[model samples]
Target: MTAAAPPRRTGPVRSEGVRLAILEATARQFAARGYDHLTIEGIAAEAAVGKQTIYRWWGSKSALVAECLVEGMLLPHRLAPPDTGDIRADLTAWVDAVLTLLAEPQGETLLRSIIAAAAENADIGRRIRESLAGSESIVGRLEASIGTAPNLTPGAPFEELSETLVGAIVLRALSRAPREPGDAARIVAAVLGPA
Candidate 1:
């Protein structure tokens, strides 16, 4: 994929409204036609914005899709994780929300596309992982929220807890088992301690 160059701005830059329209259009298109059918011209037509507009904002089709997933799909989930002073409750809520999102077709489609892209492009893989895995990362957020001591332990990894959580989510997704409401609490307990 060719990296799109930003068009020279000869006038006032486009508004956020235009960028949002494009993202919405991209989501609509992705939902209607799937990821394989995404096209610059098609998105432009759907958004009623110039093709240069999109290229200026996002450098590639994958980049645009990534933004759409971030903005339209995952933004709410990202911002909604609470730090309500109770680490177990906060993590449980966050994890449950994540699981709920994954259960959606839109979330599943976006995740599957990211996985496919990551498999083909190492950069995309790393970028999406770093970007979507929480504020700095899922691990980072958990660390910030939980704040474990510098103490040492055996059989329990404090730092790499996010990887375990991610593995659990992926396994749950692939297993296609009905998720229990208490699932997140169990995960939090396993990572943190008996609640």
Candidate 2:
């Protein structure tokens, strides 16, 4: 052969590069195949990395899935709630944002996959809760704005309300049913009431 195959092109890849590659591959696979169907081997193959690389970084398929869900689906922490000082407007806008995300095909698929994964796997469920908590800047903002109004009674737990609203949107999206814009507004009104 000519010059020993050009010296083999060796040198270890950067850890960050490998991590990003694995994450990207996992996300694409999860979006295409859902959690139940995804495999570490498949992800490794898609990423062009060794199986050990993934295992070393994420520890398990469920862990990888959890990280993928957090990295891909959830909004950034910095955005938080609108805080217009009006709970109605804030809740309405939050609901609208959630609904809009759920309406997207990728977003809907991701939500269903994560929810299903969480239901079946306790580890995944815990990770999902943690991720949701971290991603719920809006909830914290809303709670802070509400303060200790005696009549309000702290309101229905914002986390529970968020789950319900998002769950409803996911169900509607998956069922291919028409989503009524008024429905989100109504839910916000019911949960937060008039300001």
Candidate 3:
């Protein structure tokens, strides 16, 4: 839960290949062993890089994970909301993807670990929130979809709707509760009204 020191700017320019390998290794290790058990040494050995290499770039396990999340290397496929021209369908598909991830043991563990790390570190928390809400993020996609809909509620709160849909799943994951089969459709309806 330590803050990431600015990456050494003066060192030999970082090798993109090595950086990617480290991220891949971090994801693999995180999936195989939950975050609590993941270590820089394990990642370094897996990626065939030295521990100092990871420390030099990422500074801490939480920081490394934050980078992985931002780079879309933490999950199997990037969780993008499909733009199928039908906002309801697209939103439902997106919510389903999130639920699919949370339904898995690894995904649940990863979310829990990230939440724990963010809770213990303000910088990590800020990075994650920024990434999740950024223009290229899921919320941004939701905003785009909502903007195109013809019959949205007058003055619909875009950010709130985006957060509510995703936040519901996050809350479910954090509470260790099973999501119902109709949860996705219901959430989409709640956010967008009957479609």
Query: How many residue pairs in model 3 have overlapping backbones?
Result: 0
Whose TM-score is higher: candidate 2's or candidate 3's?
3
Per-residue lDDT, model 2, residue 61, is 70
Error of 2 at 19 (Å): 5.3
Give the per-residue lDDT digits (tens) of candidate 1, residues 94-157: 8888788778775566567666656666766576556545554455556565444222134335
The digit string of per-residue lDDT tens for model 2 on 103-173 reads 77655655676666676667777765555454345456556655532323466476775565556656667
Please report how far candidate 3 places residue 51 from its true position, in Å.
Answer: 2.4
TM-score for candidate 2, residues paired by index:
0.61
Where is model 2 more than 4 Å wrong at Cα?
1-21, 24-48, 52-66, 72-85, 134-136, 147-158
**What TM-score, computed on C-alpha atoms, does each candidate reach?**
0.63, 0.61, 0.75
Residue pairs whose backbone atoms clash in candidate 2 = none
Name the regions of candidate 3 deviating beyond 4 angstroms.
Answer: 1-19, 31-37, 56-60, 76-78, 134-136, 146-156
How many pairs of residues collide in each model? 1, 0, 0
